[model samples]
Target: YRTAAASASLPTFLLVGPSGSGKTAFATLTERTSIAQTHTSTQPLTIEALLPSPHVPASSHYRSPGDPAYERSRRFLLLDTPGHGKLRHYATASLSDPKSIRGIIFVVDAAALAEEPGLNEAASYLHDVLLSLQKRYTSATSSKGPTGIPVLVAANKMDLFTALPANLVKHQLEKAITEVRTSRAKALRDAGAALSGGEDEVDEEREWLGEGGEGHFEFSQMQEIGTSVSVVGANVLGGKETGSVDGWWEWIGENL
Candidate 1:
């Protein structure tokens, strides 16, 4: 029981995104070092994985291989949450629970992101995730503030010819999230007015995402809220060529 408890306390990276976005594929690959066929996940899955070679965990940079500290530093947990809209309570629980969460990896299909529905879906989910982190940061009671959580937007499916480049993926998501933020604020105002008969003003600042003003929303705004968002492109199951996901692993290592 003591051994199990110690293992369960390892730093965890939450894997979340829209369905069919390669979240399972990436998770499976990270655990087995090989891609495997996957079906749409219906529940959250947690797996223990180690940092592969040539890449070093930030905490183990000075420690050489074979050292106990270096080996322990490579050990961490990857929590894969179902991306389906109706089943996101699992992710919500993880986010709300006080655990050893280190970072979040949001996987998205680059090819699908080209369409309106896909972009909107990804943007909405991402907005909520970032807002949760923001709320957590602001609600902390510590004088020094809580440890900030970083986010990695893994733009997957680059092997497909229709996929958007990494830069466009970042831009498109930012633009779509701006629209989502505006619409959400409007809805909140309407609901608040209905409840108070327009006698009370809504707290737009609390509901608003990023900085105030008509300016576009950028990931950099998250920096002020104790979260750093990074968009990195990689494919987990490339045909004819080996898939590349080293960048994501490096990001995970840095956070771990």
Candidate 2:
């Protein structure tokens, strides 16, 4: 976790997750549209689109909503990325670029797991996206930034499909998270070695970590941090999780 010093600008966070995983909803919650505004509108608002590249006009705009809270800040730019399976394809590149993202919020839909078609599949894809993003962020940084870019694993929409155990989901995700962390730790080690003075970058020596590298992929395990909550989510976050109630405030403050 990295905090923006008092003099520094507020940290900008980018939201990414599978379709129907409520990435947009989580953004709405973070933006705090309802409380920030006199009332909440059902209408969908345009959240703005990001081009594949930073320069020039956006060829397209992905739609997301905004109310008083989100509009209040110029810093938070949540990318409504396309859903998983296919969308996950672009994530590695986007994250590697660094120019487009500051922090990543990987949303997984807990309620969707039981559903037959969309929800379950979406949930699974979202989970994979989290794994990939977690790996990429760790790999790119290797803990080198002045303030490390934070990644929040958001379990969204716990209001539905309350049956599945948290342990189960965490089990499936563990391997992926470990791999990413391992890759990143290896990257950092290589970067450190490369910085040694008066040494030519060696081909074989750079391969020290093997293809992906070594170590473990980990985060303060996934947290239920979105505004809209499920019975399952409420039970998990409100009841057990340390940061559920004030999760956003604490996380934002820490990562800002």
Clashes of 2: 7
195 Cα displacement, candidate 1 (Å)? 1.2
lDDT, candidate 2, 1-256, per-residue tens? 3253521333345556556566555455544535232122222232432212122121112322254333233233455455545555455555555454556666556555444553445434434444444444344544452233456555554444462344444443444445444554556567757787433344432222223334542334323111111111221222233224244333433343
Pick by TM-score: which candidate is best?
1
Q: TM-scores across all candidates? A: 0.95, 0.45
Q: Write the per-residue lDDT of candidate 1 for residues 1-256, one digit (tens) a residue.
A: 3388888989999999998999989888877745688999998999888888888999988889999889899988889999999999998889986347999999999999999799999999999998888878777888888888899999999999999999999999999999999899889988888999974378777678888887799999999977899999999888537358888989998987
The per-model lDDT (C-alpha) reads 0.89, 0.42
